[model samples]
Target: MKPPKGIRILLVDDEPHILQFLELGLSSEGFEIKTAPDGASAVEIAPLFKPHVIILDVMMPEMDGFEAIARLKENLSYGAGIIMLTAKDEVENRVRGLTLGADDYMIKPFSFDELLARIQARLRNQFPDLLGEVVHGPFRLDDRRKEITHQDKVLELSPTEYELLKFMVMNHGIVLSKTLILDRVWGYDFGGEENIVEVYVRSLRDKLGDKEHRLIRTLRGVGYRVDLP
Candidate 1:
């Protein structure tokens, strides 16, 4: 099969040399790369950048990576896996980054290949099934044909909505955590808000029309799942 495509990446840092190096390295791999010198610029351009992944540095001029991560995840389209890079190895910093919604963390002076590997790992986990047909009970999805239907009702789904439905159906019976759903359906790197999961689930429920034997079920504090009655 052809190589996976449609990867957009954003690099945010204050160092010109670091940005230049990462931009060049990742671009060589055929990923679209955008660079911002600081958190402010990253925020300003993020909507148009539409990056699936963002590599952010902890310290910057106007705003730190922590705030940037929170802001971007909240304001931008939910789900963009973010990787935090910093010189400090403090446990608090790592904890805080994750609390702020960073997907991964790396120390300063990291190898480009390692970073690329991390990005690819995130992508793989996010998009395990790029093509196929899956049928569970009355629900059916023909990915190759871009069609999904419940009892042949035919689901008209947005790209994101389709991805969410496909993932749930593929993992039928498993109560997937909102975090896992966000990373897989959205993008593993941009661990944005979890509310988007609820929103998408609601949309799917609306289209699927919950009735006697609902395919999607919530586990209260846990997450969600798709199953047959």
Candidate 2:
């Protein structure tokens, strides 16, 4: 499904091909995109663009991603999710980028689908209300109609199932306890067994074709969490 309209993204990379590739891909998905060849250009454009998300390359000619992030974080009055792209897979670089306020990181040779997922995840985390719809990986929830879709196809769901799925998707990255899930999805006064959550979760997994349990993860003693991207 397409994202909410007027979502702006800034792509900063030293390579022309990389910038062109991402600009084309993300623009097709209904995002307003701006491209910069290096960190200096990114820093200059970001304040005016006020991008909701910035895809920054770690290695550049004058100022790298780390320095850019520092400048952007200090200069911008609002929040923007910054994702670092680097060929290096070293833990030290990852830590440094994150330390300098990069919201996420990706290595080179990444699949477009994975990058899209990461971008969506960042939106969900940092700009949930701006999304106008709840999106987690391939799943999209239309709260206006109380409908959910996977991979752009609408899923047939019972009312309770829809509510449960909405709750899960709205809080995808967090571990939601069964009690909390029941309280939110079903009324606290409903007095149903906690295992009912298990039953519904199984049903959701089946309908979503999550036979491998990749979408909704069971924490054994804890509750479930939707782990995408």
Candidate 3:
């Protein structure tokens, strides 16, 4: 097997020391690192940098992480894997990040190993030929393309929705708890606001039409499952 390709990473943080530390650590892990001290800089350099992933700090001057993300979303060429780092770990804040299109989130005072694991997990899922893509009945997913098709109808899913559905389908036939779904899909410790998952679930169901019932099964109080009819 070929060695994993180095993932280009862009680091956005107001803290100089933290940026430097991450630059050094990730670079040592065989990743190309780019540094942006503010959200504006992040926005400016993201397309040119063409990073495969981004480590964005939530709090920054001039343009906060949220605004920078919004700007990045406006440009498809710069839309890369987004992993938010922040001191705020509240359920509402975390949900907000996921809904706003982040691929994952990590709280402050984190371990470097954990961060690396999350990055690898996201990459593995997004490029599942690197891991292994999942298929069930009429559905097929190309994790790298972030594409899904059921009965040949292509799905246009938001980034977060894609992750949620992919996780569920990959673990089909098992009842997943809300906590597990939130942890795996959202990359946070679930804090009892699993309703956020439900909201996305509903959206997925609506898009899937009648096949929703055959594919996504709700367990009520537990979480969800996905399988073919």
Clashes of each: 5, 0, 0
Candidate order by decreasing lDDT: 2, 1, 3
Which candidate should be chosen as best, given lDDT against the real structure?
2
17-72 in candidate 2: lDDT tens per residue?
A: 99889999999999999999888999999999999999998889999888999999
Tens-digit lDDT track for model 3 on 36-136? 99989988898887777788988788898888877777764534778999785466766777778787788898888768766765665554665444455
TM-score winner between candidates 2 and 3: 2
Give each model's whole-structure lDDT: 0.78, 0.85, 0.77
In model 2, pairs of residues that clash are none
Model 2, residue 49: C-alpha shift (Å): 0.7
Top TM-score hit: 2
Estimate the overall C-alpha local distance difference test score of candidate 3. Answer: 0.77
* lDDT (tens digit, per residue) of candidate 1 on 1-229: 1125677889999999999999988888888889999998999888987887899998888898988998899877647778899885666887799888887777778877557656754453344353245455787777666678889789999989988887776556666799878866788587578898988888888888875336788888999877775
| Candidate 1, lDDT over the whole model | 0.78
Q: Candidate 2's error at 14, in angstroms?
A: 0.5
TM-score, every prediction = 0.55, 0.65, 0.59
